[model samples]
Target: MSFEYYYITVVSLVIFIVALVIAIIMNSRYYKVIREYLVQARGAEAKGQAMSGEVEVLACPRCGYSTTIPFRVGDYVGKVVGETCPKDGERLVVVAIYSLRPTEYQGS
Candidate 1:
């Protein structure tokens, strides 16, 4: 082959190799970023689930006295018939625990 043809072929091959390497590098970086984002999303989802599974307490609205009553989402929370407020004579108000997902015992 002629010197000119050989030089052109070599240059073209080099260019093709460089382009392939750049493409692979870019793809690897993109995948890495995507994987990290997915991991963060999964972690956030787990945290949310754990928070939803937790039991919270309620308080007497009039007396501002807190109690460690069973908490459920969308449930009416109140004092029992014999229960009395430790802080005052005020009755307990029903307060539903808030959550993204509703709990099993979600009603009075």
Candidate 2:
């Protein structure tokens, strides 16, 4: 082969190798990020499961409207008193009254 042809072939091979290396590095980084996110999600799910065991169901004292809200072990959920009820248009005070067993966590 001519010198020009040999040089072109060598340059093409070098470019191909460089491109392959770059693609591999980028894919590895992408995989790493995906793995990290999955790990974090699993950890969050476990924590949520532990927390779901302790829930508080609150009811409006004036109107008897009720809702279940999540409560952590050391945290307190504040009550909103004298708030207007969406259903009955009456002023109500919310009071924490009960707890339920754990449920599955639905990630948002």
TM-scores, all models, native as reference: 0.48, 0.48
- Report the lDDT tens digits of candidate 1 across residue range 14-94: 999999999999999999999999988985775566565644455677767755433444555453323457678766665
- The local distance difference test score of model 2 is 0.64
Q: 1-108 in candidate 2: lDDT tens per residue?
A: 899999999999999999999999999999999999998898577557545465555466556886454553543445554446667766544355334452334452
TM-score between model 2 and native: 0.48
Q: What are the Cα lDDT values of the candidates?
A: 0.65, 0.64
Q: Which numbered prediction scores highest in TM-score against the true structure? A: 1
In the predicted model 2, the residue pairs found to clash are: none
Candidate 1: which stretches are off by over 4 Å? 55-108
Ten residues in sequence with the least summed lDDT for candidate 1: 74-83
Could you tell me how far off, in angstroms, the CA of residue 73 lies in candidate 2 after the best superposition?
A: 19
Candidate 2: worst 10 consecutive residues by lDDT? 97-106
What's the C-alpha lDDT at position 49 in model 1? 61
Give the Å error, residue 81, model 1. Answer: 44
